[model samples]
Target: MALLEVDHLSVTYTPRDQPANRAVHDVSFHLSEGEFVGLLGESGCGKSTLGNAVLRLLSPPAHITGGRVAFDGVDLTEADDEQLRKLRWVDLSTVFQSSMNSLNPVIRVQAQFADTFAAHKVPGDVTERATELLELVALDRRVLRAYPHELSGGMKQRVALALALALRPKLVLLDEPTTGLDVVVQRGILTRLAELRRELGFAVLFISHDLGTVLEMADRVMVMYGGEIVEDRPAAEMLREPRHPYTRGLLGSYADPRLPDVRVSYIPGRPPDLSRTHAGCLFTTRCPHAEDPCRTIHPDLLPDRGGLVRCLVAQENRLPVVTLGSAEAATVLGSHFPATGSLDRPADAADAAPVLTVERVSKRYTSRRGMRTNTVEAVRDASFALRPGRVTALVGQSGSGKSTLARLVTGVERPSSGEVRFTGEGGADVRVDRLRGRALRDYRRHVQMVFQDPFSALNPTRTIAYALSRPLANFAGLRGAAARERTAQLLESVGLSPAGQFLDKLPHQLSGGQRQRVVTARALAPEPRVLIADEPISMLDVSIRAEILELLGDLVRERRLAMLYITHDLLSARLLADEVLVLNQGTLVERGATREVIGSARDDYTRLLLDSIPNPFGKAAGQQTLPST
Candidate 1:
């Protein structure tokens, strides 16, 4: 028997006075012993819902409406609450996305393992089991005495993994386990998990939004769209010949920074609304190959050459299956950039009059640790410039001081040493630290920022119109009807057309892409001369990412605005930046044109960052290339 089998499983969330939303619709799949299956999709495509349903962890308003989830022949849907509780952590377990928040903050790491063991009524020494599991994930026993806050993000995630395997469960479900981590950290976690899986012989269901990571770890790949599994195939086959249009779009949406001069594309429209019932294919709205049959008749999982696909066009052989490396893929490359020649490089922006300059800036923070105080150098002698109509990208790993430098540029924090200067009105160089009262306000109005998380950056309780109007009122002195009108105009500029439709909607009501667009619109409200975007699109979906990148490029070119595009992903830097600055350990290691630095790196640290990217077309799990940098 299969280790885990989900047969025609359906989950629905029924909100009060609203329509019932079928998040997971008739999804059927099975995991054999020790098999690794990757479930991938966009944010709202129900990847998490499916995983939750399998674990029998669905809360109120999110209950299984149909089908069965059988683990080793015992149906989870029919199991009692007490029975299900017993099965978890012993027979089945899960590692959630946010490891830091998932653990109890008030207790040490060791106590958490003891609580799990006590709850499951397992017969073993909790300390011994915890220590063994920690070693399994390559963590030291010293971590047991530390609190969650003391551990790094990667270390916390490893602790969570160790807890999940405390009882040697037959299967484990990982839901976006590596999200928000740096590439190097993400690679380490995945590598360790793969090794443990082989040694322990447990089936894994890895659900993630990152296609490249999924492609790297999964033995078999499944693409979920609008609550349905549209494609299922072996990992190698799926990467080679993706049959469904949605799968093809996902594979082409992201630009791999490690690969030089590669073209990226995105799906045209948004995903379908699950609250409303659809009689046809769930992806018809965004599928480029949708036809009459796709609009009226829903397709079923039909057998193909090496896997199963749920598309009428595929069954009819209307659209040819294209491989990622095929010649015909050039048409699907989407953008109008040249296919062969080297990508455009930024002009000598270093020689131009800089709009904003950071000269030998360094910031130090003194923190109290127990009885002693320690000084941390967040940024050290960092120097860079943002020139007119040019994008200067700041690339670095997490804790490499990219964010500290951003704060220094935006005047949120003062540098302990060195200077931050910007070209003020009337073309005079002004020191940012010396600005006072109204001068400081005016300085802030001209130097705006687009933060990383759009949801947190925006006010959740307030209307979209209110969020945009605040900046206009405070920065431009616009109020009442005038501010409202400008808000509508700003919304239209960001591609959220018919601004009236979204004016009164809350931030939570909008999609990830739309929320990010609103964030971009708010930053542009002041018509700032210099815009600093800190990882603006990293949290967004792959299909939504290209739109944001293209929007930034358009704004910079059309408005002739100087931009400091801060991101850890080199692919995004390559696509949006003119100049690239590499930061490592609070110091600037390399700075040059984006194409030149990425295409031919002279520094080992710079090369390490490039080599760390997970290649979708590369070898399978445990075979990924690694670098210590």
Candidate 2:
């Protein structure tokens, strides 16, 4: 029997005056006992909505208008609040995307677990149970007393996982559990999660935008798009042969950073409009295999003799050609990985004339925890120079001072150390470090920074039109229609279709990838000579990752923007870098041409780093998956 089952489940969200927004529809699926199920899709594609519906956490305006939800033999659709409360922690739980927000910042970590146990009335020593749970996630026992703020993002996420498993629930719903974390942290978490499942024997409904991680952990996989389950199958089999066109489109959207650059096809149209009824295949607008019949008729999701397919093309082919694109992509990358492209040559004296340079920059902050005066060296003795029309990657693990270096270079923070120099495009020697007051403002105009999280970076209260226009109005002094027109042009350039579709929407309304594109477009508003992207693609999925990477590459070649690509992902750094700088413990350990550093990795740390990169092929390829934060 299935551990949990949902039949014809559809969820709708509507404001009092607004049209009904269907978050998920006809999302029928079942999780068998001890099976690991993955719900994979792009952001804003109902992945999170499905996770929320499973937990009955849909807020106001969201109602389960149709469907039946069964946990084992009991129907949850009619369960009372008291019944839900009883089942929640003991039989069902969730580990959210943002663990920082998931935990109560004011409460101690141990106390939160105590609350979980108390709510469930599971009858256990709360501290001991919490400790056991913490051990399961590889967290230390001492973390029990620490407040949410004291822990790192990874630490906090693991703590959240521990709390979710405090009562050893039969089913755990995980939503993008490792989205923002670096490599090492993600592997640690996924490993522990696997071990926990083995020991506890609980089924999981894993939700993520990352296909790689999902393939790594899940027993079964479900693909969702436009409020529906387009495909579902066993993890190993589906990864080997994805039959649905929508699934193929999802996979084909971008080149894997770990692999080489090849011709990638982007989904041409936006997802179907759910407010209006979709009588045809929901993905027909973007499907390359789409024929005349698709738009006129809807597809049913059902189990077939070949496998689970939800498309007419899928029924025709029976088994998809799992294109050995990556192998070809890998072979191309192997050929390209060692050779300097048309842009980047080996670092020599000729390449030393820097476009933007920072020498011995430092930033310090005082400890907030009453250590009686200890300083945090956010950026210490950090020095790197970005060459003209070439990507220089500044890479280090988290807390190794990458973002602080960005803040210092962007002039958002004053340096505590030496100097910054910029050779102006029009050929002026500008000492960025010595610039004071208004001079610093001029320096800021020449160099721009693109942040990682687009939502927090943008002014949420402002519309996309206003936010994009602000940069133009301030930098170029364009007002009214001119600014609006320029904003539309920029949006169109960044791959947001038509531009008008997004202009009036707020930051929250756009998906993560679209929001990121807006951030890039805003940075380009002033047409700055140098662009410093701080872990820009780290938060994105592999599909959208290629888009952003390609965009940056095109921007560098077309606009001659000096690119500073800061990231923790090695393959990304290698693929995007002209010259690579490996930073460890706030010191430059390896610095040279991209090919040189990657092919003949010099430092042990650099070698260790190269060793840690997660391979999409599988662990059998001898690649390590990063720790899940």
Candidate 3:
């Protein structure tokens, strides 16, 4: 018998004075006892809605319009409040996307555990139970004394997981559990979760947008699209032969850095708006092999290759085999670069001089608590050069000083020792740290930065035109009609076409990918010689991530701009960077060509980063389990 089952589930959100948005449409699935079922999809595809609806956790504005959520033979949709209260936490629980926000900020971890036990009237010693829970997640008991704010992101996530499993629930629903965590930390959390699942024998409904992670940890994978389940199959089979095009696209978007050749592509176009009704296939607009019937006839989920797939082409066994590096993929990606080839520097790039140089730079911070002063080194004697038309990737885990190094290079913070030099007019070496007022402004004109979070980087109240035009006017000395024209061109360069349409739209009006393009456009408005992209695509969807990477690569090649690509994602580093530098605790651990370093890493830290990457292909694809650190 199944542990959980959803029959024809549908969820809708109807805001006051707004049309009903059907977020989850006729979704159905089943989870067996101890089974790890992954729900995969892009953002806004109803993965979370389905998970919440299953547990009857949806609040106002969202309601389960129709469905039967059967958990352990109990119909959750028909259950009363009292019945739900008795079942929740004891039979089922959840770990939300943001662990920090999920936890009470003012409450100590110990108190939070006590509250759960007290509310449930569970007969047990709170301290002893809490200690046992913490140990299960590999966290120390001392964490019980700390508040939510005192713990790190990974620790908070683990705490949330511990809370979810406190009562030894039969099933747990985890939504994007490791989304924002660093690779190593994410791997540790997942490994620990897998170990606990084995020991406790609890079923999991893991909902996430990350295809690689889902494929790595899931026993069975269900791909969601357009508020519906498009594919449901075993993880290994789905990885080997995905029947649905959307599933294939998601898989193709991930590239293994350890491979000799790495290529990644994305599906074109955005997801359909759920508020509006659709007649045909929701993915038709983005589907490469979309046909006539696909435009008007909606497909139903039918058995295909031992799994359910919602596609006419797959039903007819007529789906084309399009490789990631094929022409069809290139057309779908809209990429200007070659489908498969060496990401070598252009022939003319060899003789270009260094645009920026860091000479044994170091950064330190001193914080005083009461009468005691403590000093910490954020970066130590780091040396590198950014040459024109070349991308120098700085790869490291969080708190490894990657961002601090970016700040030091862009003159945000002065180095405690040594110097940062930029090539100025007439071949002069300008000392970045020594620059003042006007000189500082001039230096900023040559060096521009694209921040990590596009949503936060952009101004909420300002229009796209204002964001781009201000930079143009200030740095390029352009005004009036000239600034407007320049802004349009900037948008076009970043691939946000029909610039007039986006010009008047606010940041919130654009999709994450569009907002990032606008951010990139604003960065290029200054016509900077050097571009520092600090985890620019970390917050974007997998498909959009490929687009941003391709855009950055195109800009570097065409404009001969030197780029510093700082990120924890080694696969992206492999895809875009010509050279790679590994950082460990602010220290330079390894440096070499991208392929050589990632494929045959020397440093333990570098290898650890590579190992942390989720391998969808599993053991057959040479993926080894991440070692315990």
Candidate No. with top lDDT: 3
Q: What are the Cα lDDT values of the candidates? A: 0.84, 0.76, 0.86
Q: Higher-lDDT candidate among 1 and 2? A: 1
Better of 2 and 3 by TM-score: 3
List the lowest-lDDT window of 10 residues for candidate 1.
333-342
For model 1, the superposed segments whose C-alpha errors exceed 4 Å read: 122-125, 258-260, 325-350, 369-371, 620-629
On residues 382-407, what C-alpha lDDT tens digit does candidate 3 reach at each position? 99999888899999999999999998
Superposition TM-score, candidate 3 onto the true structure? 0.94
Taking all chains together, each candidate's TM-score versus the true structure is: 0.95, 0.89, 0.94
Report the error of model 1 at residue 395, Å.
1.0
Reference-based TM-score, model 2: 0.89
Please rank every candidate by lDDT, starting with the best: 3, 1, 2
Off by over 4 Å in 2: 122-124, 253-266, 318-320, 323-326, 329-352, 366-371, 460-465, 480-512, 599-604, 607-614, 619-629
